[model samples]
Target: MEFNPGPPLLQSAPRRSFLKFTGLGLAGVALASAGCHIQKETPSGRLDIGEHDLAVLNYAYALEQLEGAFYEKVVAGFYGGASALEKDLLTDIRNDEIAHREWFSDVLVLKKVPRLQFDFSSINFTDRKSVLTTARTFEDLGVSAYNGAGQLLALSPFLNHAGKIVSVEARHAATIRNLLNFGSFADSDVIDANGLDGARTPAQVMALADKYFVTKISVADLPTH
Candidate 1:
């Protein structure tokens, strides 16, 4: 996969609506869906993130960058049999992810966060199954990534901000799942026995996300306090 430097593609939607949607948050929901649980890690050379809030924010920015890039490529050459609706839907999602990416970048400005390089050569945009499956992986991971980062958030406001983003991510996951196979959204595959969706840890998310990135993710000064 080639690493390209530039802004996120396909963000022409009205920014007001997107911002309003984000501000709305996930109010009045029976089951608040989160990310995959971060399990204990074995021997792996993955990067270790610090306990600092900025580290957590950096983690989020990295994933958003990946997801935004993935959708951009998909919309650029939508899979075979993709309809107008699919194109528009994915484009809107692309815009949202890019919005999320930019939001994190703004937050991390003082920290001097580096733009990440991504790998999408494995995804076959010409095939619907490949594209949808990859979307599912990303959406799931994104939700779980937020969840994993949840406990590390030291401030309520930052936690609230993360909640808004992850809830939207869960919505994106459900949309992709339903598209893959109607009614597959929130099935036994993702939701737990208690009906609440799961969340993952930073290490776990990084492990799962290793395949999508060409640049080795290096985390420095992770907050441990």
Candidate 2:
């Protein structure tokens, strides 16, 4: 997929009300209605994440939740001296992540995992560098998560959905990169010598993502191949 350097596609609704309708405000209700009755954590104090397609989708769902929360917090109170472009881009990305999280919930229904909790005490939202750098990290991790999980998806629709979402994620990563250092949208750190984007297995992703989560996640049931 090609990365577009233009401004993010904007949403028409006011930012204040968007989350109320789509984000964490309704997350618990959505999962409940979807019939995701699983306990939040097992006896070992970890989330199982399920198996096969469900596992992959749950993994994606977990990441989306993390990204959605991060962006929501960032947009709610932008960093000091934040540019108008920064606010707009972050707001757009927040909306996108909320949409992605809800979409996965709607699709997974009975198989969806419980809504997980997060702890962002380590991030300084008021600091510009910290916020954007974290945004860059989450976006890049998201792209790699989808890329690495693609091979494990057993169904076509899930695979197609992942493809569509990852392209948008790649754009987010590119946008953040350019914001940090102009012309570094597809920098070598993410894009390799063969012009291929990076990919990370479920275990590798969780290793990085775990620090921000209050909910312990277990990928033991997730397909390795």
Candidate 3:
């Protein structure tokens, strides 16, 4: 995927709209969704990320782990004898994924969030298209996840950080999409008519992401206000 460093689509929104969309002012929706349940920890070895914020953080951590693992595999085999450009681009992306994973891990530690496990059994590592398609889906989902969670964040610093991360994820999404087809980056499916990309709440995102994750996540106790 060729990375295009274009200006973000939401740069021109009115200040109020921008704040609301960026999750600075609105009350966020709770994290509860179908197919997931929350449980309190009993000090067992089993992992338990209690409540909404932790659940969401764990979600992001899981994605970073998946991306990091995928890139590691790609680099290990140097798929199809990747070109110099491919090697450099993939390497940079791998580093970014690693940073993201570590950042989330650090945050979990600071916030007392639980650890997560991933399952990549569905992805075919040997097929380039399969790998890229999965990458596109993951990157796109990560961007949407941050966008949706922005409004839910109570801390200003975290909200701003989410915005920063979302922008980078958008770039990743666009690059992966373009890898599938030239000029397919930021298609209407991702960017709305208002030029702003769409957002998906934690539940909405997890609905899709859960298939790739073996250990289930629960967000039943997350705050809505």
Candidate 4:
């Protein structure tokens, strides 16, 4: 059955109303003007993500942006064999990603990096296997990115906010995992022997995620610890 993905979300629309609607105003207050640093393209023509907390914020923003775009495309034209449950779940996930993306944008304000362009040409969205695989990858990457970046944040508020967002991302990851393989939500691939989810540094995540982006992101200035 073809799922009506409903009206498309306007990614470019102003975020103030959305913030109010989601009761995220307080969170926005905490993040207001969080990143005031002016970022420039490196000599190699890559966008430098700055240093310290701002760098981590920009990195999360970039990933959220990517996830938002990916989900939009998925809901626009769902893959074959998508069930009613799948459609509903995917739609909810899409909305979640949009909120995550815009929250970072609204809070960062001037400090938010320029929106990066993406290239989803590699995935065949019409194929269920391909779409689910890619979705799983994106969700998994988002969780790991947050887990790894949390330590880099110096501000307690920033860390606290990241914690909240990361928990949502983990839920998305679990849901997608079950969609792909009923009981693989906490499989060995993602879970460590110690029973904790694995984490990846900014550089590691960028290395895996850069292939889908047309705009080259430079994580050189991001903290190693």
Candidate 5:
């Protein structure tokens, strides 16, 4: 089957969806009155995740968890029967994803974001097309996530780190797309009409991610602007 980079299976959520989904109208109003203060409990049991940092970390952590689980399945299945080149590329991508997953895991462990649980019900591990298509979606989303979250990082180091990851993720996206076709790598669909890639805020990314993740992630504290 030819791989189709269809319109996002899920639509991005606007501000109204956040308020409705999280029931944060009253809390949002309250936070605004208090100079926009929102407190988040971190995984270490001793840290607090304030508005900006916590939200970005949570977003990255969520993506890492998803990618980690996905690559683990891909590598395991390929161990049984996969072509040489496919094996090589998938292995490389899996390693990269593991590195990303570990980076987020360590950061969350330090800040105390609880370990994440994943559900891959939507994926068919036995089918190469399905697996590659899903990988394409995730890699594309990762690039977009970093692009969208770049402005949200208040620290220079974090911003630079995000830039580093985004470049790598864009590479991953292009590779996976090309693997699905001979010349579809980094096509305009992924890049967009402006000659730039797409971006989505935490709320937007989380909304789409929620479909694949069974665990409910609360983004009530994320900022809209």
Candidate 6:
């Protein structure tokens, strides 16, 4: 809206080129500054994800589904006074999340994996603090989730798929972070001592995601061990 995005955001990192970007740390931690609620849970929502490829695939799928729905709602009722740039940025991210969701869904379909159901009542679209803060959380979560799921991929080819998508997620993370604070494209919270982006296990991720889901996800059988 009326708030400036601060300095123009640096362009998002290119494919597999995140390492080349020095200050690209995770500064979205500030998202936690805001608070928000849950609407309802869908009794039938289930992940049914198993070991290796299936686990990694569904993990990404679920996260994409969550993010896509999040952005969709954000656009539908954009914060009270959104600016043109703000609207465009959120819409672009929405498109990216939707594309990511479709890519995983297409792949999962071949394996006969069922679609996912998400509930966003937990988010309060009317509040800018709640909105941006939540956006920051999802973008950061998406990037880290991909990083964690990378090494667990079963087949070599799927790594290519993950790689392609993670860079995009990283871009989304950077943009969202910048929107919160001009120079926050990258911050120490998400980067490790080795200057690498941090990773999270399936258990760790599902625990946090369960809060917003209408259905509690079951990743209990995942070989994330």
- Give per-model TM-scores: 0.76, 0.83, 0.73, 0.85, 0.74, 0.76
Candidate 1 differs from the real structure by a C-alpha RMSD in angstroms, to one decimal, of 10.0
Q: Could you give candidate 1's per-residue lDDT for residues 83-179 as a string of tens digits?
A: 8878877888898898788766654443524666787888788999999999999999898888777877775656777887888888889989989
Overall lDDT per candidate, in order of appearance: 0.70, 0.80, 0.65, 0.82, 0.67, 0.67
lDDT of 6 by residue, 110-222 (tens): 34235556777777898776888899888778778878778877555567657877888788778888888888888899877787887887778877778887645566655
Which residue pairs collide, candidate 5?
Answer: 42-112, 43-112, 43-113, 44-112
Worst 10 residues of 6 by lDDT: 23-32
Q: What is the descending TM-score order?
A: 4, 2, 1, 6, 5, 3
Candidate 2: minimum summed lDDT over ten consecutive residues — where? 1-10
lDDT of 2 by residue, 1-225 (tens): 222222243245443343344442254244445533344665678887766677788889999999998988998899899999888888888888987887777666666777878999999999988998999999999999999989998766567667888999998999899899999999898899999999999999999999998988877778878
Per-prediction tally of clashes: 15, 0, 1, 0, 4, 7
Between prediction 2 and prediction 3, the one with superior lDDT is 2
Better of 1 and 4 by TM-score: 4
Candidates 1 and 2 compared: the better one by lDDT is 2
Candidate 5 matches the true fold with a TM-score of 0.74
Runs off by more than 4 Å, candidate 4? 1-39
**Cα misplacement distance, residue 162 of candidate 6 (Å):** 0.5
Clashing pairs in 4: none
Candidate 5 local Cα displacement, residue 196, angstroms: 0.9
Model 1 residue runs over 4 Å out of place are 1-51, 219-225
Question: Which parts of model 6 are misplaced by more than 4 Å?
Answer: 1-47, 110-113
Residue 189 alpha-carbon offset, candidate 3, angstroms? 1.3
Between the candidate structures 5 and 6, which one is better when assessed by TM-score?
A: 6
For model 4 the local lDDT of residue 217 reads 79
Per-prediction RMSD in angstroms? 10.0, 6.6, 8.7, 5.9, 13.0, 12.1
Candidate achieving the largest lDDT: 4
